[model samples]
Target: MVARSLLALCLAAVAAAHGDHGEQKIIAGPLQSLWYNRLPGDGGTQADSVFSGISTFGRLPYLPCLSHKDITYDIAFIGAPFDTGTSYRPGARFGPSGIRQGSRRLNLYGGYNVPLETNPFNSWATVIDCGDIPVTSYDNTYALHQIEEGHYSILSRSPATDADKKGPSLQGKTLPRVITLGGDHTITLPLLRSINRAYGPVTVIHFDSHLDTWRPKVFGGSPSEVASVNHGTYFYHAAQEGLLRNDSNIHAGIRTTLSGPSDYENDGYCGFEIVEAREIDTIGTDGIIKKIRDRVGTENPVYLSLDIDTLDPAFAPATGTPETGGWSTRELRTILRGLDGINLVAADIVEVAPAYDTNAELTTMAAADALYEIMSIMVKKGPLSGLEVEAGDDL
Candidate 1:
């Protein structure tokens, strides 16, 4: 056995040295006796191994649309690639594709292993990539409505059958917990609209560099010239729609230059408490976690929206509104890891503009890493065996 093993190892090394060429897949010649598979990008095809057919957010199946009756999912991954509302940078429109491309190299099975013990995909539930919504351009009103309609269509058929009222609160539940890849932060507004229709008001856990509650930051006439519907003011509208539980809603990692004195007061009026970017250092990671947990509480359903700019420009410089000083990716990951067992109904990771990313795609990769962490948190939400049971009913 020892001699045979040695011989096999020698043959494997020789085959590896030969390099992959043409349409060859198997280890040819002297290496023919062994079976060594490669990853998707390991010189073979787009479809290979466990990583085959990978999609954004992770190696999830890409469904043409989420409304497919044959397949029911516990999680849905969708993209919103419209970025006309971006105030500074215009390329967030490509964020979805960039984030997706950046995730191609990552292992989807327990991709977030450092923070958790298990791969959510391995034991928890099922997930599907619902593809991207073809958001309308130019017409901000139609664009938002299109986004809202797309989200609503998915929520209308989603499994979250129950609604929660207070902290650590959960009503009844189904799956298809939505995870959106963004065109920009404005996507959150329409997304909240969909969530409100299905699950009612939820606690919004916002991670971003800006407060995003400025009502007069519109592009027209003056601050309040046109409707306050840009990427900068979605939370204000969400508040007006009563889609959020204002007091329970919280913002983390804010480092933006506030427009005026009332910015803080305005955010408070919108029903949100602010956690400045520097607070991460002042409060420490654990302290920040404690504050977030304490503020959001455990009763109500929660919706988490992460803007990649929450990280400092040094780590994530591709966002429209990059902040000079902010939390490190490690700190953010630690904070997210600590948020286990929260009744998280849905989440989104937005503003990864690859156009301005490093050659290594540090910004997009950071966003991907965050998405994986969120998946780990979802794993802690108890075994989703019920989702499987529910999905089986149709068969």
Candidate 2:
């Protein structure tokens, strides 16, 4: 009874907090207007220009893209939409669409002092939701190769159209800004490989219940085992390939399980620096931010990967793996917000399997909220410079 009462109180508090806008009006101008009431059909031509720049996923305005062509996208929200890599359950491929559906209801004008929705910072930026990358196969390996090849092709600037020559050319034009929606964690392998080629090494902010560094051999097969490369061993392969600088570069959250100690020792794994959700509660969000900053440095390019299971089952239950002790939505938001100054290059929100969620609430909300946080950060950081979307003027 006490627990139920506490939950009720917490819900009430959140509602009150969200509703306490006081006199803050819902200004609806161009979706870009700073003033609260600039509705979409306002008379200003600039408003239409701004609206056209913004991309929509389902109903919510996703990343804004300036153009689309030559496979160029400043912020491509590609949906992997396949979870075959998962060892425990299958269904994360549904994540992208679910998230897009949920995002439709989100208000573009964030209230209060939220930095992402503010003007000046957001005015010059171009973010876009390029929709899902087309994948014809359900087979994990085939799908991964397709994803890798597709990104490689899109990023390459070489004039060669032949498959043989195109391979090397595509490698040359890889953009630095991309946000992939996952079929599962394993998909990150190809995505990271693409990013590594473009930006070199990067630090990863991994939020999940497991370290995800276990080798496929530990699970009784070689790394080539499709199941091994699935959600469980992506980081392991990344580390082996020298993508991560060290274990310190990978900061994990809410880890309560391990493949074993031998795996940690053999590779000089530093282990998760931060463990236990309660520790976050005690040290406070700012403290966690400081820890991340200290490790990755303020200027190092960082990638954030959020596994929905990182949130407590109560808040995000539609995941292949659900862990009890984890972060709440508010806590996760605080953490992302605190990392504002860091050089976040690319990010992904994964492992949201909506089929398991009858209400479609868990994966949907988590995915949209995660993207919102990432977009918030990007808007504050300024235009990704050379990585603009490639679309005809008609878009």
Candidate 3:
């Protein structure tokens, strides 16, 4: 009887602690008029604080770009989270989410980019963060196809703004641009292939510490073709497959040790003009900008691929391969800002391995800021025009 009485008292206390599970009324305070019908701060929801909500790139709205054909956007941020192609460290598979986490503070205070004078989020374009591609870790070939198809799906769509239709287009329609959060440098091959279908061949502005145009036999002999496709040699495959425009592509910040002078010869044959990292000391950022602009020119559709390791280990130590002497974050951002009028179609920032990042998230934050600059430029210059999308091109 005593035990039963104690159990009854405990049950009563638990119920009281739980309280009523119903719609409870919120007491309107003295300042209720300020927020009565209006949404909370920044006009976002009451529960839409950056620290609490589902994280997307820049905390932008999420859309299933692949599944939904009806929802059109001008710019879409997509994640390709596969790192099997990495030659050195391997945590870049989580690069997409890590970049999103680092981008939380973007546009939080105010979505304005003063340098280029364009606000991507609030501009004429409809921007959305399309969630990552569902790439399988078990199969590299499958993952490659997945990333390519996901990119093409977004690239082939017409922009939400009908006014953008007057711009240059190979498809005869103004298509939306994609800013891909990368898995590794190897992802560039499929991206180029997709871009080829949309715009015959594009100038590549590659920023990295190493030349990625190594022949598979030169990089390391692979037993199979699939095995040969890796971060270091994808550009070789891209060149062989005719995804690049000759005499226009350029590589910046290259300081990696090469096998021999033949490697530089091979890089040149692949249609890339090299700008060594040490050149920044003499040429300055402006010189580097002039070289890139001169090489890429003002007409052709250009693809900008920035590997996080292009920054020195001191600034971006979390990447797969860190070189000691590289461009500072500010220097790289300044270079990017200078390429404002070029026809930049689609771009990617790859090799950001957040597992190797410091508590400060230096690498991921730097990558995010670099992307912010790229976004600003793309917004400043609308959809790429004057190119024709080659039809029925085999990949």
Best by TM-score: 3
Clashing pairs in 3: 168-385, 168-386, 169-386, 170-387, 170-388, 170-389
- The residue ranges of model 1 lying beyond 4 angstroms of the native Cα positions read 1-55, 108-112, 158-173, 217-227, 383-395
The TM-scores, one per candidate, come to 0.79, 0.73, 0.86
- The prediction achieving the highest lDDT against the true structure is 3
Q: Model 1 compared with the native: what TM-score? A: 0.79
User: By TM-score, highest first, what's the ranking?
Assistant: 3, 1, 2
Q: Whole-model lDDT, candidate 1? A: 0.71
Over 266-316, each residue of candidate 2 has an lDDT whose tens digit, in order, gives 434633354446678678877777787777766555678888887888888
Q: Report, for every candidate in turn, its global Cα lDDT versus the true structure.
A: 0.71, 0.60, 0.82
Candidate 3 positional error at 266, Å: 0.3
Cα lDDT tens digits for candidate 3, 1-395 = 22223333544564566565212121222101111122424543343356665678887766677887666777889999989999889999889999999988887766688888888767766777888988999999999999999899988877776635444455456777899998999999989988888777778999999999998988867778998999999999998989898878999999999889999999988999999999999999999999999999886678999999999989999998788899999999999999998888899999999999999999999999999999989888865544434333321
lDDT of 2 at 299: 54
Candidate 3 Cα deviation (angstroms), residue 305: 0.5
Write model 1 residue lDDT over 104-188, tens digit each, in one string: 6556333436557756544445555678887877777788888888876765553422222111212234545778888888899
